[model samples]
Target: MKQYTLLLAEDEPFLGKVVKESLEKKGYAVMLAPDGKQAWQLYTSFEFDMCILDVMMPYKDGFTLAAQIRQANPKIPLMFLTAKADIRDVTQGYASGGNDYLKKPFSLDELFLRVAELLKRASPENQPADEFTIGSYSFSPKRQELKDSDGTIVKLSHKESQLLVLLLQNKNLVMDRKATLLKLWGDDNFFNTRNMDVYITRLRKKLHKDPAIEIVNIRGFGYKLIC
Candidate 1:
């Protein structure tokens, strides 16, 4: 039997533990993240067959995290668990790339059934592309590696890779500075802002071999990747 790994991001401790244990007992390997920040960290660091996110997590909500995840890997199965009964919230979940939304106060059995259904519908052939092309470079954000046409490979740190992906997603368009800071650092304070600037500089130097690939700052706005 193949063991499918699942990333479950739920801030509720008791429910998270119960769900994780239930999934593990059914022969799945589950990585439980207590908040959206740690969830994103786990996501970029590891690969998973599916994601189960709770809507109102701290640092980042499920919708924002889902958008980021969808930007990175479009085909992965995303399921949202939320207590909010509003129809708008359900619509927002789908808009954020969620494949299924389960209302809270539901049974564990139903949760298991939904998870199985989503996984069954996912196709390997339709999975996200393993590598992305950026000018003369071949990059795999999952592997944290950037390879130039000359075959020189530059390794990237977690923050560097995340920032690079964000820039690539908004290629040729301005990526909001404050939004990037909040998404990556959980805050847009002076210190994290400085840190982000440093990472941007490092990325620029790493991709300097190709003059066409430029990560430009948009003054008071954000950064843009021009390739």
Candidate 2:
């Protein structure tokens, strides 16, 4: 079985064809779907290492499709490829179980980088120490879930999982914002920065159950996960 199979659902024919070719050239076997309904059908028929979906489609939207995908397989990495840049759009995408977001008109290189990063993190060979204990919360990276002191399990999206892992890796030190953005989003642009802010807020809200875990803001620097 191929290790990096992908399912890409984009409504735009030109973009879809171009992206499909690009991914295939980069050695990812891709299954391209023109709409969310067919995308869901393909998803049900085959297993993909990751999914790239457009936020808008003919039959079903990306958010709805992602929700269905999440119900089926919570750990499969998913990315939203669309033109929507509004804060609410980003929030909805993450809430809908997206692991990453790439604004439309994106370069193929950037797309490749994002997909590769998500796959790398999801790949078993790249996973190290599946579970980590932090401040009364036990985190399972492979499962993208956190269990709190009260026994409530909080499911984390891909970006959230990666962000938390990076924070845990850095512990009490300040995580560099620019470096982190570059690694994950391929750029530290204004829009991406805003998206990061939203994700940070979500993470804080989720971790609020445990007072010991604080994602401290270091003015001008980045954030520090005080564990």
State each model's C-alpha RMSD to the native. Answer: 12.8, 5.4
Best candidate per TM-score, number?
2
Model 1 residue runs over 4 Å out of place are 125-227
Range of the 10 consecutive residues with the lowest summed lDDT in candidate 1: 120-129
Top-scoring candidate (lDDT): 2
Name the weakest run of 10 consecutive residues (lDDT summed) in model 2.
179-188
Q: What does candidate 1's lDDT look like per residue over 28-64, in tens digits?
A: 9999999999999999999999999999999999999
lDDT of 2 at 55: 93
Tens digits of per-residue lDDT, candidate 2, 16-47, equal 99999999999999999999999999999998
* Angstrom error at residue 164, model 1: 38
